[model samples]
Every structure is written in C-alpha cells, then in structure tokens.
Target: MSAPSVPPQSDGGQSGRPGRKPGPISDGVGPTHRAWLEPLRTRFLAGGLTISDLSERSGWAKSKISELLRGAGLYPRWEITHGLLQVLEIPTWPMRRLWMAAALEAHKKPDWIDGCIQKVALTTGPVEPPLEHQAFTDLNRDAYTAYARVFLEDQEAFEAVQETFDLLWLHWHEALASSDVVAFAWPVLRERVMDRAYHSEDGHPELTHAAFNTLALSHLTDDDARFRQIAESLALFRAISRLPAPQLDVMVLTHLLGLDHAAVADVLGTPIAAVHSTDRYARKSLTTVLGPQHDPGDAPA
Candidate 1:
C-alpha cells in the first residue's frame, strides 16, 4: 500500500507569488513526514488525549508537546512521538516501526549533532583545550537509526548502527576536527556501510534488479501520478548506483551529498575537470534513461 498524501506545507502566501509551488520541509521528504504525523495528530484529538495527559504520561513539558504537535520545532523527536503513541495506548513494536523510522529521520539536525558542529567547525583542526573540551556527544536512537538507513535496510542496519557508533565513540575527536560536520556526516556514515558490505560480501540486489532505461519507467501510471513520481525517484537512484564507480561517486557527492564540484574533487582526489566531466556524463545518462522531455519538476521539491 501507499503512504498517505500530505497537503502542501504552504499555500504560497509567504512567497507572495500566485502560482508558485510549495516546497518540502527537509530533504524534500516533508509530504511523507506530514502524511504519517498528521494522522497521529488526528487520533490524539479524536481520542480526547489532551496536552495534560500526554505531559503527565511522557514527562515532557506541555509547551514542548504543543510545539511538536503544531510542527513548531525543526522536527519532532522519536521519543516524544513514541511518548504520544503510548499515551494513546498504541503498540509501536512491529507495525509502526516503519512509520517511526520515517519520523525518526527528522531527528537528525534537531538532536545532538547540530550543536556540537558549531564548536568543532570553528577550530582549524584537533586541539587540546582546557581539559573541558568534550571529545564527542552522544547519538540518540533517532539519529543513530537514520545513520544506518543511509545505506542498509532492516535488522542488519540496526545492528550496524549500534556497532558503528560504538566504534565512532572510540574516536570522537576526529569528528570534532572536521571543517564541516554537516559535510562529514555523509562520508562517515557511508564508510561504515562500505565496510559492512565489503566484509560480509553482500550483493546489492536492488541495483541488479532495477531498470532505468525503460519506457515503462518513463511513463507515469494513469492511476496516480504522485505515486509514479515516487517510483521514478527510486528508479533514478538505482540507475545512478549502477553507473561506473567514478561517475556514480561524483554524481552522488554532487547531488546526493549536496557537495560542490570543489568538494567532490577534494573527496575523490581528482581534478576539477574530472568532476565536471563525470557530472556531465551522469546527467546526460540519467536524462537519456528518463527519456526525452522527462520533466524533473515531478521530483521532490
């Protein structure tokens, strides 16, 4: 089954534009996030579970609960969301895990990592401080889970996240030395995945089975254009994965990691020209695979 459809985040009032489209909240996944969370909000109201009840059960402040429900903060924390679920006597173990997974990703910037970055990024490199300079802060369950989801799927991913952070916990100072922690997250997480995939010798079944250069993929299904867009995105990602390693790496660094050409060149230890060439090839191949006149407007906003 498909996920629920979310209404536009804005009605274009803020932009003062008549026909401009609404944008996603973060990573262009706002619709999916709102779709799942909104229903829970509805249930909370329908069940007559007031702020006092949730506050009493969860031990979180009423203002915090109110802000979360109203979508006031960066993103709702999983613990808070889980607390609300328990207040409603809902079981979160098996079925709601997927929904919770999606909700948890919103926790990335909201939690510990964001604050530490400011302190660490200001410094040139690792430096000894007045015995009080902390090496690393803790990773919450939500952020830990999202890190693994960057690569792996299901139970193995969970285990990988646990093991990976435990190791990172060993060398926390290195993260503190990075020029940009936001940029650092992608590589650090992906390296853990690369290690796991290499050590265990697991094959990427998704890429082997996926097809991008097909007309059927290019054509939107009549039943639901929205759903078709989601399918196209999956296909596009898979196709990118199947590109030659250099091209794939460059494309992923540029688009997926939100890196600039200079950063890509730095990461890959390649010249700027190679970065440009690889990106050009990647785009041209994707455009061909997506078919002539394939509009990327349908992609996430």
Candidate 2:
C-alpha cells in the first residue's frame, strides 16, 4: 500500500519495465501489473498519502507492503491487496475487481493481460478499431464481449473481447483463406480465455513462494453474498462471470452464446461427452450458486 517513491525523472525507478531486471528478470512484475497499478500509484500520491503514510495504514510489515506494490514475482493475496485498496480510498468495486484480476493474471505473462487491460480500459469506443488501431475498436469486439463475458467482469469482459479481436487482427489473411472467420477465430478466442482463467504453467498451480499460496479467484461461496447476488440476479453478465472458470467456458458456449454441444466441444478441443458433462456441471453449480431460482435442467443437461 505504500506509495511508490517515484521521482519525476523516472517511472518509479523503472522507466520501461517496472520490476524488470537484467537478463529477463525471472519472476518480475510484468507489463499487465505495471499498467494496472501505475495509475493507482499516481492517484495514491495525488491523494496526499506518502509512502510512509500508506505503509502505516496498511499495517503490513514494510517489507510485505513493498513486495505487494513492487510485485516482484508474486501472485498477491486478495486479502492483503484489497486491504490496501480500502486504505488508499480507491473508488468503485469494479476497479477493485480489475485490480484483483490484473494481479491474478499478472502471475503469468504480461502481453495478453496488458492488451486486455487496454481493451477494457478503452470501453465506449469503436465497434472494432481499424487495422492500424488508429480509430474504431473493430467489428469483432462484440463477439469477444459475448463469449468472454462468461469468464470476466464487465470491464475485463470487454478487454477479453478486444483480445479476441487481436487474434482476428493477427490472422485476418488466414481467416480469409479459410473462408470461415468464426471457425478460425472462435477456437483461438475460446482457448485464450480458458487458459487464462484456469491452468497455470503446467496445468496446475505453481508454487511461487513457501509463505504465500496462489489463491484461485474463481468459485462461489456463501462469503461472496454481495457478488453472489450479482450472480443470482438477472444480470446475465455477472452470472456468467461468477461461475468457476471451467464451467464458464462450457456454459457460455452452450447456453448464452447459443452454441450447440458439438460446437462447444469444438471450441473446447474436447470430446462431446466432456462438453455435456461440463455443461451439466456448470448448470448444477449455477443451481447451487443461485440456490432455488436456477434450475439445472433449464440448461441443456
């Protein structure tokens, strides 16, 4: 929570890559985290909370707070970071959610995460920004939001859509030759969100440090009443986002996006039976999360 002691001359002692070191800086703060928190640091300083003041308020040992902000090769605790957000007096729950997501995503690569952040951050513009990225968001933006909305918050959802468009942008010629942008792009978009939502480097959580554990951000519980209400309510957006990462891809593809079981399987690169099982589990989990209002059978199970 301590404000970064960044002088005007430097980008907080990190002109380009914030926590980057010589020769790749193994486990350093990636671009996504730096992009996400740099603004917070600026606002924190603007609010007149000096580094010492934030350190005092966070009540975290100076070392812990520094580690959190510097964010060198750590997954970051929801409890600790959320506490700092509270102390910093950052406005809005969405921003907190963004921080939570970026922190979580930051544990991996920065390129995609930072790209998604930029996309969501630029909401309320172009349907699809042109090829040069000079104007307009792009036509495929809607498709990303529609599918990605399942795995991400509203803001992140939009960014996910943009990421999908980024794929479309990359493979424009291939898609043209394939004569099916849907087939070509959907698989890429679907897997991108899925891998980011779940799977770590080895399809399992990697131990970053002994003292701290990587807390998976998905899964709903009684403790999530506020967010759960958002899940339960008619807000289709929140409902999808609240589901566990695995369930989200299946449910969103099979239900919300109107893809059939086989199509879901294709997008997931799994068998038809696996898709059905995932779909059933997702609906059942929704029933539990929604508790009475939702009927698992209402889904294709």
Query: Relative to the true structure, how large is the alpha-carbon lDDT of every model?
Result: 0.49, 0.50
Clashing pairs in 1: none
> Over the stretch 258-297, how does candidate 2's per-residue lDDT look in tens digits?
7788866655556789878877777777766667566533
Q: What is the lDDT of candidate 1?
A: 0.49
- Tens-digit per-residue lDDT, 25-58, candidate 1: 2334443354445545655554544676668878
Q: What is the TM-score of each candidate against the true structure?
A: 0.33, 0.33
- Return the lDDT, model 1, position 85: 57
Best by lDDT: 2
Clashing pairs in 2: 126-137, 127-138, 128-136, 128-137, 128-138, 128-139, 129-136, 129-137, 129-138, 144-161
**Predicted candidate 2: what Cα RMSD to the true structure?**
16.9
